[model samples]
Target: MTEALRLPAEKIHAAELEALKADDKERRPPGWALSPRAAVTYLMGGKAANGMPISAKYVGDKRLIETAVATLATDRALLLLGVPGTAKSWVSEHLAAAVSGDSTMVIQCTAGTDENQVRYGWNYAQLLAHGPSRQALVPTPLFRAMEAGKLCRLEELTRMGSDVQDTLITVLSEKMMPIPELNESVYAVRGFNVIATANNRDKGVNELSSALKRRFNVVVLPLPDDMEQEIAIVTKRVGEMAQSLDLPAPKNVSEEVARVVAIFRELRGGATMDGKITLKTPSGTLSTAEAIAVMIGGLSQAAFFNGGKLSAEGLAPNMIGAIVKDPVQDKVVLEEYLETVLKKRPDYADYYHMLSDLT
Candidate 1:
């Protein structure tokens, strides 16, 4: 296969999956790659029975992962709900990879998505030549997953229109998709399930119907519980992404990463770390993911423009962009934060001046 700009979890962790499967002595659920116990271990990271080190993909509560895995072991589908940058989609991809050994079967839901894209579409020329036959049918990722007993991912589920979102009602509840045109129905094989993600902060999201919501085992993924956790996530992801994109590895940025995470945590919490003062939160989520982006941006700026030295002045532009979503409201929020919070800290006086100059 050609080199991809990014690899799915399955591709990146194929060896770990193999090791887990090899040592999986427990009874496997119908078509799972690893047993529930081993799958959890694969996610949480540990040495398999064969002594292969499985790296941790997620950095959160172990019980939440157990609940998510246990949900897939049953008949119900899994719904990962969270605000942006909470790793809902990341966890979903890894779960599918660990459970089914294939994470490529994905349908990215969007506002423009239609029923045909979710279910199936017809090949124009082939349809004209052969009419409604299987040969001319273009099976979607969901249809193929159902036929193959694999996991199918639906990303940004709430971004799609209500009518298009409801197309899965029958598929989730009945585990079958009817094809009246071909006079045949596609029944989901055992182990076939859907994993979907939706950002809670999305505006005007098409809310899932009560009936549709009932079909899923909902798992709400919260943001990193503390600063250290968020910092670790950002550092690991930034290193991996920089390597993948062939960007220069930043030097001595751990303190910067901690500072970035601290800023986001404070803004998100709407108070200083001591909780003595309140802050007006910005329109932006200020998620850990965005912090990583800011870090990477600073690294790039340093690498090409500043003689490979990462500095607070170099990060100011990216930090400003990440924090300021609304020109008027968010700017005021950030300005107040700079004056009330950053300006008061002796250690952050340089960052305050740098950011103030840019704004």
Candidate 2:
């Protein structure tokens, strides 16, 4: 198969989705691609009865995925909230794909997002010629979702302006969007719902109003709680991304992956793995996503420039970039970590030397 620069979850796992649909015998809600049970299986991963391979997308708690799937199966909308790198948007996309069979119906909420983008806009040329007809009315993702009875995604929901964010309140509560120009409203069909994601870091930017909050069944997607789980997540994602980009695999990536996860976990927790030495946390969040990015970038460099052998030398630059958000404060944090934790670990002598050289 020809590789796409990026593939939607539905497209990437088309066979799995098809297998789930065929294997599903349970009652499904209207317009659903698979039954709720089958949707959860698609998210959490399992072998279909026909022995088709289903790749697991989200790696955390199965119950959490179940709750997310259940939320969408009902009239209430779903809001995935967490800190960065928790895979909120990932789960949102997969859920939309599994339930609606189309993950492209997404409305990315941003600081500058406006009502017209959320609702519907008019084609001015057609509007002038046709005079307020349906043909002149351009439908947004929300409008299309309402019309076709499918799941829609709103990413970074809290990033949108408060006034613009409230536009969803009516749609969630009443299941309809009003077009004053057309003097009519588009009511949602039975399977129509929304899945939105917001992070705690942006809580104050465009805080969800209490009225708006009540409309969604909120699910908090927490960071991976276990060390091994986080390592596995980073390792698999990095490998998959590398393969998709056709980058050669690094000779020592697994070792690097484990070390990277440990460093991030220790730094972010402000303590060593043994919990003996207390360290100062950096200004940056040092999220798992950033760790994955650093590893992927380092792997790319190693593959193309360093003859496919990843070393501490290759990883140092990206590590510094990921940790040192506020150079003045975060640099001190990294320095202290190096002196206290990394320098003491005999096995990490090369890492210590490389980081020291960079600093």
Candidate 3:
């Protein structure tokens, strides 16, 4: 059977969601698929009351997940604020899936995004024929979400123009979207709420106005707290991605994964793990998400080119590519790190040489 290249969070976790629903005994907000507590359990990973195993989606703070889930249960919209690769979009997708049983109601906000995409547009063909009737109205994702009382996701909310971003003010604050052309409005149903994601570190972002900011309950998803946590996250995500891509698991990848995570942590922190050697940080985020991508890329290289064996050679180029986002300054930062940090560590000799040669 053919499969989707990517599945939305709801379809991917359908069984676990069903399991949660079966075992959930707590109060459920209207239009929610699972209770808030059960939804948190789904995200944080725990066995259901029926003993069905539920996988952990987000591997960070349980309280943060709880706060995000709780925000959706109320009238206030949720804004997941974080640096890039901090899993803002990841959490948003899963939260929408867990609460609404449908994570596809999404508006991917971009610089070119306009009011029509956020609100409603006219079906021109129908409009010309029917002349401003409801049949001529083209409902956007946000419109559909309001009509259905499900969560609508706005990704990279800050990337849109300020005027386009302001269009959400009414939909969020009043839970109503007006249609001046039709002389009618779309009043949101009980569970209708918005979940927006924005990266604080991104450039050219249209900062949220104070009025728009007040409509959302901001929950910041932070980076992994430590090396072990970051490593665990990367390992888990890489394993899952490999399975999805039909790639054979590279044997003894834990060590390589650890090394990659360590390098990212050091450069990201601008210091060595032990804090003995100060280093210049790179331009890239070196985020856990990027680490997962590097691991998966390395595994693919091993699977296709190196007789199903992972090595420093396979991981080096991708690791360097991830680190050296800005060719000049980032390369300098990485070279200093390799010379000062990895060169001295005995276990990292292979990585040091491989990365040095590539750089």
Candidate 4:
């Protein structure tokens, strides 16, 4: 298997859900592998009664996970609102997998997304020959999802043009897509649903219409709350990412990774871990996902440079490089964090030393 062909999500183990379903004692909805509670557990990571473990997918809020799972049970669509790296797409994938046993139905929304792309499109060459036959129609993921009554994901929904986003209104509320050219129409089957992810940081984006907004059950995913949770998330993600990339297993970087994630979470929350100090965050959101990438990059650096042991020597410099994207402002913010919070910590002498070596 060549490295470039692999995706991290492919390495993400989903058999855990299947196992839970096999042993599930709860009531399951029609076409659902596990009940809503079991699906939530699969996403949020929980201990089963039989000691079967489910890996956490989203790594954000528990309530948000519940709300997402709940929305799928109802007629309303689901909207996962958050900044980048909130695992909005990950949650959507797992929900689809547990609900329908498939996650391939998706329309990746972008600035260029248009109506025909969402609803249906004609094979232009076939259209020129056949001229508006059903054979010429190109069914999008949204179309198939409606026909089969499965979850269809719309990623980066806010990046889509306002007009393109509105293409969802009728399909959502009316649950019907009409094709005037073919003189045909299709109604959604039972269990049909949509999951859309939007970033809050993309302010002034092509905003959704009130009519469309009414159709979705919106749940905002938040950053990890504290050090332990953040570390746990980064550790799991980095391990999974390393395996997926076919990179050698990273070792002994947990404290460094923990330190980096702690910094990001602190800056994100506008306060120190102890809540004793407050600091201004930079423009960068410093998502948990990014922290995993940072550590993986650092590990790669260590492996390539120093025989695969992650020395403080290689880790600190790359850690600084990852966090300090904006030299002037982020540098000042980082220096402040080091001076006030990190420098005085008795337990983390090397962490403070790493920060000091940068200056």
Judged by TM-score, which candidate is best?
3
How many clashes does the backbone of model 4 have? 0
Q: Which regions of candidate 4 deviate over 4 angstroms?
A: 1-4, 7-14, 23-26, 46-52, 274-277, 338-359
Clashing pairs in 2: none
The parts of candidate 1 lying over 4 Å away from their true place are: none
The alpha-carbon lDDT assigned to residue 320 of candidate 1 equals 91
Per-residue accuracy of model 2 over 285-335 as CA lDDT, tens digit each: 788888999998898888888888898888989999999888799989999
Over 4 Å off, model 2: 1-3
Model 3, poorest ten-residue lDDT window?
250-259
- In order, the Cα lDDT scores of the candidates are 0.90, 0.90, 0.92, 0.80
lDDT of 4 by residue, 115-191 (tens): 98899998999999979988899999999998998888999898899888988898998999999998889898887
List model 3 lDDT by residue over 82-143, tens digit each.
98899998999999999999989999999999999999989899999879989998899999
Q: After superposition, how far is residue 27 of candidate 2 from its true place, in Å?
A: 1.1
What TM-score does candidate 3 reach? 0.99
lDDT of 2 at 43: 90
Q: Which parts of model 3 are misplaced by more than 4 Å? A: none
